[model samples]
Each structure stands twice: as structure tokens, then as C-alpha cells.
Target: MINYNNFIRALIIKNKDIVTAIVFMAIIAYVLPYYTVGGQGANAPSDGQSVGGGGAGGGGGGAGVTGVPIHVVQRTVFQRPYELLPCTQSVVELKKDLIPTTDFPSLVNETVSKFKVTVLNVYNTPDYKAMLLAEGDEKKVLQDPHFLPASATCGEMILELLPSLVPVTNIYDVANQVVSTYHVKVVDVYNMTDYKAIVILAEPDNAITKDSRFINYNQNNTLSSNYTGSGELDLSSGHIAAPAPVLKEETLPDSIKRTFTTEDLKGNAKSNFSKGVDADIAILDTGIDLNHPDLNVYRNVSFIPGGKTGDDDNGHGTHVAGIAAAKDNGKGVIGAAPGARLWSVKVCDKAGECKVSDMIKGIEYITQHADEIDVVNISVETPLSPALNRAISASVKAGVTYVVAAGNYGHDASTTSPASDPDVMTVSAIADSDGKCGGTGPALKAHNVTDDSFAHFSNFGPSVAIAAPGVDILSTYLKGGYAIDSGTSMAAPSVAGAAALIKAGDPNMSPEGVKKALLGTGSTPLTPCEGGPQGYFTGDPDQYKEPLLFRKLGAK
Candidate 1:
């Protein structure tokens, strides 16, 4: 049977932060139904400073909002590299190509037909990972199938192996019994097209093997797989993801509502602006929570039917919405853009993903409704698809100041979806290097000087536009109350809020002008990021030191 839980744990939170990994550790696989993995992973410790208690990964949530330390996972796969033909062979002449011609293993299989089909290679640039995804006719493939590990997944993030490898006649002659080889086809995640591939593998007897070879795109990483009990084969992993979710405290340094309450509303977002003036922050996500007391005023806004509409099913959208525009009533927490309005168009689901179809719907919503929203904040990402790009281009043309997360995947120059889509301001997270890493527990202070420092979890690249407060941010959650979370997801909105403050000051500013103002005005931290692996960090802090972009962008 196909194990879906392992696939979700490995893929969704695979290579990101430690929180998700910790979840994998604590949250047992709900198998017996469809998943089969045991509940023996890792869990986060409730103790202080004890971050990495899970399997092997944990996101560094430093005390202050400085550059928090983070670690990335290494995934190496063992497999024989299949090269496309200049050396051609036919299925009728099948019996070959299994073992190396020179003292290799044996190659045998009774089933044989056409040895080749088509393939699609999809890549997650931020994660430095790629999969050869393809789908084909199952019955046809089983006719002359080869015996291997049968596969099934919960989502569409897989690469169909059989179709990509040009078929060899005697590819699996040594199998005890073919078990009536079944041909299964999978979608081509890379191209998102009808690339066909053959499936020749049945469920194994024992999940241990000693003959498998591992393949590394770069040769240094190792792969982990749940199918292999002997731990020979593994899934290609990355870094950064869900953290030990904590109840959020509703106060901070420049907190307009915390230290300064209703009376402070004079200059605060909750008081000054027109009732609906903030209906401009386009929440690019799964949807939002419009019924909440703090957010009821900005309700009834829609982009399209399934278009630019606001209905948050996925927790991410609601969480982000609360961060950008949640009402500041005494009940819930305050928002970054307290005065900002919210427009929603669903793109992701409960599992934190959206079908390409829905994503296109969301982008088109923003483009058509550009005039309605002010600062567009997007906290979603995926492999760069052409269709996705088209949507981004449309939004930019509509003159929206797009802000996106740099992604929590720690690497150099790895930009997430709309962030790397060009013309959008991509933001990174910072860590609190001071001794107060977790001092005073919730009510924290942002060390602006120490912050803006590069975070190990924050993705850096030439495409990274700016940095913001990403690590350990206290924001709104799905059910009701607030929570302490981490990710580039936290950083993007900070800049979006800043951008809104500027755009609100000058309603007629151009997207390019808005960007120049933000980057130009914010104070540059230091030069640690400049020396990063791929020159992904800012080259010099000198520029940021002289002209603080915050002053410029927020200048009324």
C-alpha cells in the first residue's frame, strides 16, 4: 500500500524549519487508514533554549528580532543515472540494460514493450531539489512491468520515475514474480503537462535492501526514505518549517496598540484613517476570516467569484490577514497595517498548497482588483511555473506593490514564488543575537541594529529585495486567538505594512517609486549577509547605514 503520511511529512515540512520536523516527531502518523509509518519521530521540548528536540532539524528562534541561527538539512539519493540515448535500444530487443554490462548485476523481466516514453522535470529552486514527474496508462505499463517499490502520494509533488528512464528490455528479469506488473502514471510536476512514463514496480516483501545506489545532484547530500528499513534509500530533504506553536502575546516595541491604547488611537491606525481607507492590502493567500470583530469592517470585498474573493479556509490566509489587517479591538491582537484594508483570493488549502488553477485565479484577482487594494502581501510559494509568472506580471502591470516572503528554506539566492517572480519586494527574517534570546518571554524588543542581521532560515539571493522581522513573530491564528510563529512568512508582511504606510502617505506613487523609497529609507544592519555563500546577502551595510529606508518610506 502507498504510504501517504511519510510523503506529506517528508515533502511539506521536508527541508524547512524544525517546527514541522518537531510536529513530525510529536504528531504520530495517523496510519492504519492509509498511512503506515509508526509514531516514533521527534518532538519539541517545552524547556527553554532547547530547540532541536525533534528528529534532526529545528528552526532557530532567537530571543530578540535579530539574525536567528538556523540549520538546513542535507538529502542525498543513491541511484543509477539514466542517460538519454545516443545509444538506442528497443523494447522488442528488451532483455538488457539491467546490470552494468561489465560484471554488473543480473537483468531479467518477461514483460517488454516500447522502452521509452516522455518526462517532466520540476524544480524547487529554493530547496535545490528537482523531481522527474510524469503520468501514463497503468494497464499498458504493467504489461511488461519491472519490479521495484510501488509508490503513492498525498499531493502532486512527485516525479514519475519509470516514464523518465528510457525502458530497457530485460530491466527486471531477476524478480521472483512480476505480480502482474501494473503500469501506473503520475502527473508531470515540472512541466505540468501530459508527459507519459511507464510504471513497473510492485510492493516489496521486506523494506530493506543493500543493492540500491544513491544519486546526488551535487554529490554531497544524503536522501532519507520511509520505505527503506535498512535506511539505504532516503528522501531528498531541505530545511526550515513549522515551529512549536505558542500562544502569541499582544505587545511589542513600536507596538501602536500595546503601550499606546485607545487614547493613542489619535495617530494610531485604529483611529486616524477613514473607516474603509485600508481596503487596499491585498491578502494573496488561501482566504481570510471576515466575521471576526476586529476585521468585520473590511468585509464583503471580492476580486472574482472564485476570483479575488476573501474566504479563509486555510489557516495561513487567516493568519496573514490578521497580521496585515486584523482589527485592534481589546479581544484579538493588533495588526501591522492596522489601518489597512484586506482583499482576498484563495490560493492554498489546509495543507498549505493551491492547485495551479486556483493560484492563477488569485493572481488574476489582484490584477483586476489592483485599484481596490494598496499593498499586496503574498506569503505563498511554489516552483516557478510559467502560468504563475503570467499572473505575477499581470499584478505588476496593474501597479500593485507586491511583497512576498524570501522563504524559510535556508540557502543563498533561493527566492520563493512571487518573491522571485520579479518586480516584487522580497523580505527576509532577522534574529536576536543579544543575550535576551528569549528573555522577558513574549513582550520583546526589536534590536534594530542587531536585527536586519541575516538569519540562517531566511533565503538570500540577488532577488531578495529587503529584510524584515520574520523570526518569532506574534500574529493571528485560525480558530481565534494569536500565536507565536516563525518563517519568511513573518517577514514579508512587516515590509508590506511599511509599504502601506508609505503608499498611504502618497496614494499616487508608482510601484518602482515605492520600492526605492522602502529600500532607500530602511537603515542597513551589518555586513554578515554580504559574505554569504552565493553572494546572496547585501554586499555592504554602508549604504543602509547612511540612508535609512524606513524614514524615507514611512515619511508622511
Candidate 2:
């Protein structure tokens, strides 16, 4: 009825709108796969349970179909005071009132729920406040008021931060990381229960920043790095180019036999022949001269990695070893226990600088070989370190007798390590100038002096266990020579050698029993130091005067 072309045009225009809508819908379907849905990214979880859902190629929620699981990384954190405690105090009591109870969970909840912190470790000491390591955002934790409580019970707080991704396997790794990341060198590593605590030294022009991992961890750990006071392992001897003539009639040179290695001290005389025959002693000091003519060094081990050989280069260890176990060969000086075997554990370098970590490594080695070694001598001194003290205590419990120097600072030995350790025998220095036998013998007159009382430089305190000849001491030196030196370093070996003698006399003697024997048999009521610097003594002069070493083997 109507014009056919016009009717067709009207129908096409009417359907054009619908056709355009269909084309737009098609374009959206193609592009929809390239974008996200519900404003969630491709990696975002759908409902906080699963990840990678409702995305371009993501699978829809299904009971049978699996999805990628979400993962949360864990970090290890540490917290301590910004400064070390002036003296040892119980860390448990320091924080006892902060938490509901002493159990680990209670402490964890207080930190976690309140500040979103994760407590990974709590290192407590009976002598000092506790240190903690936790995982959390350092900024948030520090900002939280509860993070460092205002209460006195909370004590001072220092934060130590470790990388969440890095895995710390041992102390060496911790030390390396501190050096590489912070540009600070670690001077010592303390072996804790599950962590290796480090003492760091900041580099010049690169001071440790507050943001540094060490500080952000705990400020107290930072205090350990600033402790510069150290005690000395005295060495006053010099090297003699030529060897001394062998004694024709005596098993030991008169210089030594008249003092520490005398028959009065149960020291094996020339006729005893048994010397420290079957016993073993380990010396932790500078490297020993393995090629020396007088020493019978059984083993030479170096704790200083990438350094010189264990052979004595500075002549300190050589001198110490000669004092402890120089052979009975007539050509040179004799040791207190000449027949006993010697293990030279070099923890120091030629300049006599020993890192606390190196010394700890040397201690660990002695601990592992405790069954083979009966005596250990440490002629080095450092500030009070609880870690080193624990190591020495452990070694003592393992049946090893430790003889350490009382230090040469002429101060309170209790302020120093090894000397302050109760389990070890701390030896002080006495100058026996006349080589006399009586307790009231003449004062030491050697080195161009009249009075040979306490060496003017010897450290003395309640911690000292015994006294030995340390002034103008003649012993083995470098290049197969003999020299005279003096220090508490010389005094400690005398006691160590005495311990070897005691062990040789009674192989079944316990460490405690040996200590008792040494202390009980010492020659007491000896004349005190006279005509020397007197300010070193902080206590009664009589109390600082330790008993002279004497032999009481096979006596009840």
C-alpha cells in the first residue's frame, strides 16, 4: 500500500539504534578481559581469603577449583637499652611488672595486641636486664607509647632492626651484614642462646645513624660498641738474638726453678722426669714460634682468618708457651710443666690486638676439645662481657681448668673479664728479684730496683687467686732465642703450668678440686709489695696480696 523504498528506509533507521548498541556491547566484552573487576587488581584477594580472583584470566569462586594462597613474610627484630647497664642487673625484674605474668605468651600478647609487634626472642640474664628481638614496623612500634613504656619497670629501650628477607645463620653473617649494610665494623661477636650479639665500631665520617638497624633494634646494644676501656696482657720481654747456654747440672734454669717451678710448689723437679708428661694445656694468645728450639708445641691453630700463620711472629705467645711448657732440653729455659703437651691457639695478631670474637672462637675450640685438654690459659684482658664469662664458665664445667691473667691495669680485677670470672684462677704479678725461698724473702731487686714487691704495674684485687714471678722474667723468644719480659701475662702461665702439674699428679682430680688444691697449698702470709706505686690497691693491702703458688700433690 505504501512506497516500498520509503518503508524499507524507515525500518532500517529504526533498527540502526539497536544495531549501534550491539556493536558497543561487543567492544566492551573484548576489552573487559584486559582490566580488573569490582575495583580489585589482578593480584588482590577476593574476600581476604584467597588471592588472584575475579581478574582477566582469574578463576571464579568454586568449591572444586583451587586458588593461589596468600603469604605473609615474618621478620626478626631485637630490642634492648640504648646503653649497657652500668652494672649487671636482672632484666626479668626490670620488665616483670610490665606484663601480666612472666610466661612468654603473656609478654607476646602485650606487645602483639597493643602495638602489632611480634616477639621472636627474649634474651634474659640474671646479672643484667633482658634484651628482646621482635618483628614489626619499626616506625609504628617506636611511635606506639606502649612500645617503650613510661614506667620505670620498662627501663630504657633501644631498637635493633634486621632485614625481614635476610636469614642470619651465625655470628659471622651478622657481623658481615652489619659491616656491609651499616658501614660499621664488628669488633666482637657474643654467642647468645639463639643469636650472635655483635659489638660494632663505627667508621670515621660515617657515624651510626638513628635509622641504622643496630640502633633501631635496641639502644643498649649500642653502648657495648662505645666501651673503649680495656685491660692489658702485660709483656715486658725482649728478643735475644743468641740462644742461652744449656744448664749442665739443672733440669730448669735457676731463674724459673727458684720461683714458679720449684720443688716447694710440687713442680716436677729435674729428677721427677714425669714433668706434665700425660697432661695437655692450651694457650690462647699471640701465635707461637713452632720452629723455636725450646718449645714442644703439639698443635698450632689460628683463629684470625686471612691472617699470618699460627707460628709466633710477635714473640708474645712464644714467650708464654715457653713459660708454660718449654721442653727440658738443656739449651734453653724450662717450663713449669715441661713434659706436658702444648696447644698453641693464636687469637691475637703480631701487634697483640685480639678481637673479642676471635677470642670467643678460640674458646669454642677449646670447649670442643675439652676432653683432650686439661688446662687453658688466657693471658688477655677486656672489659666485662657476660658472653665471654659464660663461655669460660661452660668450659670450666666441662672439666677444664682456666688460668687467666689478673690484668696489668693495676686496677680492680673485678672490673675486667676472665679475671672477674669466678670459675677461673686469676693470677697477679709478683717480682721475685732475689729468687729467695722464704715467705719473708727480700723484695724483688731486678731491673735496677731495690724493692721487688708487686711489679709496679701489676693489677690487684679480691679477684686475684695467686701470685707468681712476672718481673724481668726470662723465657723463650723469637728466632730460637731467649729474652726477659714482665707482665701479668707471664704470671698467668705460671699458674697454668702449675695446673698441668696438678693434673699430671692426679688425672682424676676435678676442676674444682684442682682449684682448691692450688689455692689451699699456696704459700700465704707472704710479704706485701713495698716501695712501689701504692695507689693500685683499692682494698686492704693484705687482701690484694695473693698466696704464692706451691705444690701439694698427693697430699690430703
Each candidate: RMSD to true structure?
A: 25.0, 35.0
Stretches > 4 Å off in candidate 1? 1-279, 296-309, 413-415, 432-453, 526-556
Candidate 1 lDDT, 80-177, residue by residue in tens: 12211110011111122422231211222112225343324222222121123233322233344232212322111121223333243222231211
TM-score versus the correct structure, for each prediction: 0.47, 0.51
Candidate whose lDDT is highest: 2
Tens-place lDDT per residue, model 2, 202-255, is 222233444333433233434444221221111112334443323332234323
| Candidate 1 residue-pair clash tally | 75
Per-residue error for 529 in candidate 1, Å, reads: 18
